[model samples]
Target: MRRDNVSADTELEYNLRFFTQFIINPARTGAILPSSDKLCEFMTDLAGLGDVSTVIELGSGTGVITEKIMRKKAGSTTFFALEINPAFVDATKRKCPDAVVYQSSAENVMKHLEMHGESGCDRVISSLPWSTFNGETQQLILDSIYDVLKPGGVFLTYAYVLGVVAPASWRFKKKLYAKFDKVETSKIVWSNIPPAFIYICEKASR
Candidate 1:
């Protein structure tokens, strides 16, 4: 079940995990397949990884983004990947051994970070589906993210091109606007399946 090395990703299993998981829980998994290389590139490029001492990744499904982050900025910072799915945590850990993969919810990020003796991170890169959660759950996730982030920290997440039109997606956008000082939306990443856009959010700089 484990790969020989962290870099080795079996093409078949990688595709199945995302597809099957999305079918079972479209809201949580979000994507029909793993995020595309181009999308990952755009997100990480704006992450400001060089300045942060600590960064955590949320909802790391099959470690596509996680792997890309590790590959690009592994030596610059410490990454702790928090995923709710045990299977995903396993795959992410295998793919990104340098990262600390925790099977935990984003709502409990503070507790998990403390349990691991980690500090509030400077950036949070999430792949969680905000449009699926009810208002309360959405607020809870945002609250948790805001609390765990350093005052001037940044938080980033992506949404499908189609989801932007949904009421839930707009509501989520409003939540982001309300909670953060600055929220920057990226141009569409056409290479991704279903196409998508990245939202680069940041708290006010201290």
Candidate 2:
């Protein structure tokens, strides 16, 4: 079935089920997979990606976001998609043959970049469900992203609204306030069943 034909909720459920079964134990890992098209368009629009020359996506499931990034095609910008699940990684590679697909976790993204002699990325977009992650794991991934992002780079992510959706989490809010100079959020995409919010964070100027 074509993506456009599927309802958003159905698509979300299918992708979530795929992640839960093959990628991470939904109960243990706390990874909630968003549909590829929704996440890709959301990240691209949030990042104002027209000027960005390179992007690194964390938890690129089934290469949905990768394909979206490819659609933007700003100059010769390169997209690096990281997926911990082997099956998802292979799927992403097949979908976006131009992308540099890495079968690794977000925590190791910087290491992979270093190995490739890449100093930093222009933007980092993620779909990892932070609410499901333990505090340490969450901090580790965030720190790694900060380490690899270029000065003035942006980090974009999505989260489901639970108790409080505006700020997302106290910890994430604190980190963004302390580390980034600017952090903005967009209105919830009601089109997405259950809805989701997008956070756009920009690194502080040196």
| Winning candidate number (TM-score) | 1
lDDT of residue 200 for candidate 1: 87
The alpha-carbon RMSD values of the candidates against the true structure, listed in the order shown, are 3.0, 3.9
lDDT of each: 0.82, 0.72
TM-score of model 2 vs. true structure: 0.81
Candidate 1 whole-model C-alpha lDDT, 0 to 1: 0.82
lDDT string, candidate 2, 13-65, tens digits: 65765666545566333344545356558767777777777788888776677
**lDDT score of residue 26 within candidate 2:** 64
Candidate 2 lDDT: 0.72
